[model samples]
Target: MSSGPSSYKIFDVTLKESVAMTPSLQHCVFYSEDVANMARHAPDQRIKVVLPLAGGEPPCLVDNGGWYPAWLALPAERRPPMRTYTLRNVRPAQGELDIDFVRNGDNGPASRWVNHARIGDRLQLIAPNAAFDGNGSGFEWLPPDGVRQVLLVADETALPAALSILESLSAQASPPQVQAFFEVPLCTDVQALDHYTFAKIHWLPREEQPHQPYGQSLLAALQTRLQIPDDAPRTQDEAAQGILRPELEQMWESAAPAHSAFYGWIACESSGVKALRRYLIHSCGLQRETLSLMAYWCHSR
Candidate 1:
């Protein structure tokens, strides 16, 4: 494991509340009076959360009076577990940020901690600096210019980021037409999203069909909704399409021109994401520059 710099500033936060979005989904809010600077974070970006391990040392403040994360303060061998969660919403006026956690019956440390979190419980958050230093932050919702339509697909783990992206898009003066598919464990897991007038949301409940694997429902929905060409090219020619790379970073930086009208973004379990990426590029004929595919998590890992 790698440790962050000792000089890294960690914000001390207190839990505001943990609300049940559904039987198995939770919306956790944490607030810090010093987080007004968080307004600089792009919508749907992620934050590193450091929760104290059971029986670990309490958090402390550095000479600058900024709280240091308890997990980071521990010796390398004793550091607590840490996780990254999406910033679902930010209220700079109240210095609050919301993170949605899906409880899987204590299968993961973060889920277990969030399941029992209460009001006024202290926690620590490592956020991107106000200057936007391009470190310790992750954001990938980049739609190039002239995109007029979008297709978004995600499972429950990525629902928070997907919703945040939708919210950001809806705030635009002329929002693009959006078709979003979300797969969740329960139908009730589908919550209302405000200011999403231009979006068509589809909720798929996997609990209704026990044998269906994660991401299959979303893939089915995509197949039914989009008209994938039967004779679409399997792969773009390397000489004609410019140098192709396997990494998203390299593909994203390539000076390839954007697809004319449609953009697609998919995030979910690793296997599903890879399958969807292949289908979109080879079957749907979407340009690599117009789609963003990410493996939010893996079921087998």
Candidate 2:
């Protein structure tokens, strides 16, 4: 996109490296000559990617500023698979960015690309233009300014984002008391992650003898810790937005009262998150404003 004169632009990026991270995560580094124009707007900075076709990964085309509309106009066979991912790090000076991919050994487009990607393979990324002074969206880790106790729940898909939030929190003057429940595919997937001193991380592996649901461990953990009252009065703000409805395809809400001492962030499979949304608000009586619930993926069993 000619180095992007607009607030956001498409960049042709090369796969610099694809390396292993724990048992379930793949760390990929992409570089582009135009990456120097990309700027990180938030710790949970996310970018949209056009996945390469099978075999040798090739760079895909993004049609102008209205990327989606143009792509949708293309023939079904010509249309490429597109997905959103969080950035692990951005090195504007080096024209490089890192992303953590959760590898479930599935035949999904992303996992297939990761399984076959070569060092020089190419792809497309849409990211913020460094020169833009405007605000960027696609980030949801915003808690109240001085929140104390924080609850983080995620499966492998959202683990990278959860860790990114913790990293951002660590930089604060007085970090919150973070209790993070990270569920992964196996015990070996549990590894050391950088977090603040007050943060206590609990890793749940799916290797348990009796098979449990993906987010069940996190929900059970929270049930014991949080005091879910018999009822919670919803504010007009929440009621107006249908925040009480968990049947939506996915949920993404981030609005916490400034006076709140504790804030919860939950992201995982669609079904699990829907159940969590219901329990946290209706059953547990948690104020809708004190929590941010995001359904990251829907697994079709």
Candidate 3:
């Protein structure tokens, strides 16, 4: 599992530049002469960024310190310090780094910083950190010997990580059959993704006048579309869980009896991911070792 760096100290850094990923997302690039001073980082890892308060200061270190560590070791008001974001890309050789921010507007300091960020802006940085891999290895049960297919299911938040994994997997190994389900607001959000073996990408578009939060409904529909027949004898109570249970049953009903294998990756809203994880483990009889499940973001957090 990951931990704070041995050389834990703040770095005075500045925004080298920023660009638009979408109308609502910005890619902020930062530079530091002290880049070599930080610890090694990993994809999906997070770091804290301090933003100056309105009219409090301009390019000034307003918070008690220039920058503070977030998501780890801090006071109460600062408990959930700075918005936690993934390290999108890094270049140690060039002394540059990039983190993409989902523009949620002034509701958050981090979001606000990104919304107004300009070239040469200054801010504090808690050196790049790594993700916790409590299991002590990479995706242990995947690529089960002789397995030749891959399936990735996720929302926009997990898209970066999913793409990185797919590109790496496609380049070195014989391309595995891949399918992806992505949820995004508009059609333009669809862009070139790395080619994988027999890839089929499904896009679930957001509504103009949203009938409801479309992600939940899309996931519910997927559950309905993938359901197994009721006759397979297992447990009676399995039918009680809403929406996703039948999909799990269907996945099990469709699988081979013995060693013919499939690898699954899923990340999404917390409740939905948790539901799928339970179904994969309990109802489908999938080894916890065989599936990669992550709750990328929570609804109410």
Q: How accurate is candidate 1 locally (lDDT)?
A: 0.70
Clashing residue pairs for model 2: none
What is the clash count for each candidate, in the order shown? 0, 0, 1
Write model 2 residue lDDT over 129-181, tens digit each, in one string: 78776677667777876577788888898888888888888887888788888
Score residue 180 of candidate 2 by CA lDDT: 85
Model 1: lDDT of residue 64: 43
Native-to-model Cα distance after best TM-score fit, residue 297 in candidate 2, in Å: 0.7
Writing each residue's lDDT as its tens digit, candidate 1 over 1-301 gives 6343332356678889899988867999888887775633556587767776666443443424333444446587566566777878778788898888888777666787887777887777766556344454357776766768777888888888898888788779999888888989997887776458898888989887788777888788888876433332234555423322245322122113344466677788876776676566655555666667777777863
Q: What stretches of model 2 exceed 4 Å from their correct place?
A: 1-7, 54-57, 226-250, 256-259
Give the lDDT ranking, best first.
2, 1, 3
Candidate 3 residue-pair clash tally? 1
lDDT measured at residue 208 in model 2 versus the true structure, 0 to 100: 63
Measured with C-alpha atoms, the lDDT of residue 126 in candidate 3 is 59
Residue pairs in steric clash, candidate 3? 228-250
After superposing all C-alphas onto the true structure, candidate 3 shows an RMSD in angstroms of: 7.4
**Candidates' RMSD to native:** 5.3, 3.6, 7.4
